[model samples]
Target: MGIFKIEGGKQLKGQIQPQGAKNEALQILCAVLLTPEKVTIHNIPDIIDVNKLIDLLGNLGVTVEKLASGSYTFQAKTVNLQYLESEAFKQDGRGLRGSIMIVGPLLARFGKGYIPKPGGDKIGRRRLDTHFEGFIKLGATFRYNREDYFYGVEATQLQGTNMLLDEASVTGTANIVMAAVLAKGTTTIYNAACEPYLQQLCNMLNRMGAKIKGIGSNLLTIEGVTSLQGTVHTMLPDMIEIGSWIGLAAMTKSELTITNVNWEYLGQIPNVFRKLGITVEKRGDDIFIPAHKNGYEIQNYIDGSVLTISDAPWPGFTPDLLSIILVVATQARGSVLIHQKMFESRLFFVDKLIDMGAKIILCDPHRAVVIGHDFKSQLKATTMTSPDIRAGVSLLIAALSAKGTSTIHNIEQIDRGYEHIDMRLKAIGAQIERV
Candidate 1:
């Protein structure tokens, strides 16, 4: 129920480091349940989602120890599967969609899994059908009783088989991977989500003695093993956070040096930003943004016309960032059409942008065309509630660069993803007060 009051139109300066990837860290935390041995994860972001996941693990009796800042050691040596039915367990699991990943691990190790509908951002119709389909293909029988979804598998006798996922649901792909790692026979998962998060999961599983081929590609072949040993792993820097920071700097005309950014995983981000005329300089592992008084311009198409930035699956501009890109497009000089194909309601927040005097056309539920009026940013402070994590941050960015004071309530949604976002923004000269 907290709110952020921000005085905008301030150019953020100085250096900031994005904490670890939220999606990757949550998936990795569930991987800890795959083994009873100790697994130490470094660079873990202290965020709501991650904490909720940790709470989920604790409910299952996993021993978690917070070491230093951004580091934690987990020992799930004795997992009590019975706690899955607890009201507290169900409430926390339902709060996060990542809790579904635990279903596969629990079913694989304990032969049964039960969890209510998982919840997270209410962007659109996020289906668990794909996850259930993949698990069923792996020889598990699913049952739905009123609100509880249960999976009962004779896991000891379960045999791995080829699974072609209907869609590349990120968590669904990861769920099957965790379930297949300890199955009896070989498991082949085609059309898999090979994002950096999944790659880290594979790497951690490999260290724990799971045979997985195709680290960073769509098709993955997993050879089942009898048991997995504990291993230590560190999560990669959050590319989405880095991209968000890049967008932030470009929008505010601020010079910021983003440190510890893993340049290797940043596929297509540089090109995507280039389309918006945002220039980035690479200084070793860090990216430097030079301040610009004149707003950035959107690169035109081959016909010297306005361009469009749309979201696609992996190896493309992520849908999760389409909201941020839309907000960034408002400050650019030229026009660009932003598309949010994955979620039906994601483009709804453009009304807030339009209220800030941005020139935007809501083409449909999933697409919005933004024309940069380059309005003098005469933003009057207004009270708005955050809708989702990405959209919430986008609004925050717009608020920081706008004039006057703006109050954003329901910051817990924003806290779910970005780590210490307000504190980090304040480091770069953003005037944000939490109430």
Candidate 2:
């Protein structure tokens, strides 16, 4: 059942919980390799990409045990360094994009790390240069095998130094931070990504006895430590998923509650949805999206110009949720421009929405104009393919609000990010089934 068969025009109700963050789980899971002691993590999302990383850790001889649902304990006391070069390791690493993150932890403690080209959503060109460059500044020798698309880094010992990242990449910063936690000197990372995910990693490392300062800022200073201890960490709710639920509720004219949304960490998400005139009421830690018996409206700029939304680093709108925002706008009351600054191919799925009667003009690969239908006419159901994780969920949201049954192929992309989405939606009155 790799496809989702959704019966549209259903009014969904009841509450849903956003799973642990997919991004944060990737970084935090890789960080278990930094220590040999037992580390327990709670709120772990049961998703494909994260499960792949956990299985990869098992292959590397990190003893992982399931303590309970959404909880696990891991110990890397006897890591199998030889597995790094095995054919089986190559295949496992190739299938998971999060596998690249294990390099820093392995290189730090074992003095060597090797990885085949990692895989994930084929959204666009994602460079590994920043990660390697950071490792190089930490005094690790880097080598690349072009024929095999393999990368390796080795050092007798890593000596940390000052470096400015070419781009504020979240994964790159996470990799560099993990490596620097075990280096011999001070490491100053400027222009580092300070997303909530990165901050969570730093906090977890500090709990494990690493010296990290300037969390939630672009400049991070890491005082190297000889070794780290084990600690427990609980992840924040997935803000992207919360935003998607907001979009889903608005599109379907349904009243829904999203619990324990971690409001402060949500940053610009609720506000951005408000810009589209979706009422997001906060009750305790939960988000209540009222049924839009009357359609929502898009707010104009202060000067009465069209509202423009764009993606940036942390404290800015996340690129991950722009697709949901775009899909929600198809039924709002005004026009808006969505500028997808980071990824070149992310906005390509708008054509699928267009096929379902959305009045979206693809301005380019990175920009689009969404003219809201104001619920005057419903989207016509259609079959579509999921291109990437975010786009896949966005399409699913569109299908759930369309006029008839809709079929979405390549739901594996969705499964990689959202945990038990079909089952959870079914619990909340969504007519979605795995077929």
Candidate 3:
């Protein structure tokens, strides 16, 4: 674990670029196993989780070549299937939740796939049932080992079929899509997760010779192909990171321009921040957030109810950015209820904000009511530990707008999602040090 020592009450001004989407990278990297030919990828964020997956791919005998700073070419012509049973693989594969997606491509190509219990942030009960159930629906035999905590799926040949998922899980949809693309017949997936990441995956697969329809909708149709060829794919900018920067600029009283943000894909994110009375200017493809010198005010509902910010599926405010929204609302003029409907434990980080003098009530595991101080009372800096990826960045924002220096332990959580976060913050004049 690492710690970040931050000196607060600094007004920053500059332009920053959002990195490649982390969620998308996880899906796209695993999708590399679908083809044996060279697949080149660009704009890959050099973060911990992504690098871990890349390393896991290399360990599985995929030839990986770093073409440039954010470009890599992957070829999986000679994969060592025997390594899947090794203890080293079990240890390595358990580090990321995205590791589950690898099973789909492996099972499709090799007729069998094995995975240890995958690990991720303790935000909530993220069920893998959706992935496995989708596999079973596609004619794969699923088996789980209780003692080893491993999951295996195998079939002589997968047959594509119609599946209406219980929930629109992003990785689950990606996994089943990968499997269905090489199956025997057409697969119709209703209630699919159609986020821009999935759209990009579908587009890339289409370029690779997989026939998929419905690029940006909840229903996806995939036609099983004999084999997919290699193709080049570039990731879009990270919308969650861009949203975080917007909240950071308002809370810290900074004028920051987030460059190349892929405005079309950032659904409701800008409007969500604007509802909190922050000024968001869209200049072409960039977003310029001016420093809120007079402080921001929360806009109440038409019925005079307290503002409620909640998370939902794509086209709704992402649950990942609700933490940032909660932290930003602490300095606003009115109260707002942040309902983290997707995760049960994510709202607990508000207790750290209360420790820093922000008035927040933990209504429950899924909800927090924030009473903004209107910048009349500055938060007092204190020592805290980061619990997860989004919460870590939210705490960082709080510390930057606080009255004194603060230390945040367990900064590895932040590093997993953001690439060179401290360096990026420093470039925009934030006083943060990795200690």
Candidate 4:
């Protein structure tokens, strides 16, 4: 585990570039297994989860070549199917949740797929029923080994069919889409997750000769192709990271400019922050946030009701940013409710904020009511542990705004999502050290 020692009460002023989307990279990297030819991908984020996936791919006998810092060519000409049954592979596969996405491409192209139980943050129950059920709907046989705790899917030839997912799961949609792209016939998926990551995966598959429509909508139609050819794909900037920077700037009263953000793809993120009375400016493709000198205030609803910020699907505010929103609301004027509808335990981190002198009431597992201090009271720094990736960054932001130096342990959680976070913040005049 790593620790970040941060000295708060410093104003940051500079420009920072968001890294490649981590979610997009996970799906894109898995898609490389669909073709035998070389698939070149650019703008890949260098994070722990992604690196673990890359290592797993190499272990599966895919030829990986580094073209540049954030560019790679993957050729899956000779995959070691036998390796999937190995104990070492099972242990490595369970290290990250995104590793489960590899099953779809493997099942589609090779007629069989296997994965160990996937592991990720303990925020809530992230079920895999959607992914497996979608595969089963596509004429695949699903079996789970209880003793070994492994999942395997097999089909001599997958036949496409219509699937209405129980929920619009992001990874589930990506997995099903990858499987359906190489099935025998057309596949229609309603209530599909159409986030930017999924859209990029569909576009990349289309370039590889897969027939897919509905680029940025919930309804997706894909016609199975016999085979896919290699293609080059570049990922969009990380919108979550962009949102994190916005919240950090506002909390620390910093003048920060986030560069080259895909403003079009960042749906409702800026507006969510603005609802909390944060200053967000759009200068072409960049976002410039001026320092909040007099302290920011929460905006009331049109009916003069307390504002409520909740998580929803794409084009809606992301659940990942709700933690940042909660932390930022601590210094705002007036009160607001933070509702984390998707994950139950994500709001528990607010207890740490309460320890730092923030007035937050933990209503339940999924909701919290925050009464903003509005800069009249400054949070005193303390020792804390990062619960998850998003919450870790939110805590880092809180420590940046606190009065004294704070130590955050288990920052490996933060590194899993954000690439070189301490280094990036340090370049922007932040007082942070990794120990």
lDDT of 4 at 157: 98
Tens-digit lDDT string for candidate 3 (1-435): 799999999999999999999999999999999999999999999999999999999999999999999899999999999999999999998998889999999999889999999998989899999999999999999999999899999999999899999999999999999999999999999999999999999999999999999879999999999899999999999999999999999999999999999999999999999999999999999999988999999999999999899999997889999999999999999999999999899898888999999999998999999999999999999999999999999999999999999999999999999999999999989899999
In model 3, the Cα lDDT at residue 258 comes to 95
Report the lDDT tens digits of candidate 2 across residue range 101-121: 999999999999999999998
In candidate 1, where is summed lDDT lowest over 10 consecutive residues?
147-156
The digit string of per-residue lDDT tens for model 1 on 1-435 reads 999999988888999998999989878999998888999999999999999899889878999998999888999899887687677777777788788888878877777777788889989898888877877888887787663654334344457899888888788889889988988889999989988889999999999999999888889999989889899999999888898998889877899999989888888887888888888888999999888677788889999877988887788778888888898888887899887888899888888878877788998998788887454554445668899999999988888778889999899999999988988899879999989
Off by over 4 Å in 3: none
Q: What is the lDDT of residue 146 in candidate 1?
A: 66
lDDT of 3: 0.95
* Residue-by-residue lDDT tens digits, candidate 4, 1-435: 889999998999999999999989999999999999999999999999999999999999999999999999999999999999999989999989999999999999999999999998889999999999999999999999999889999999999899899999999999999999999999999999999889999999999999999878999999999999999999999999999999999999999999999899999999999999998999999999999999988999999999999999897899999999999999999999999999998999888999999999999999999999999999999999999999999999999999999999999999999999989999999999999
Clashing pairs in 4: none
CA lDDT, every prediction? 0.85, 0.95, 0.95, 0.95
Which ranges in model 2 have alpha carbons more than 4 Å from their true place? none
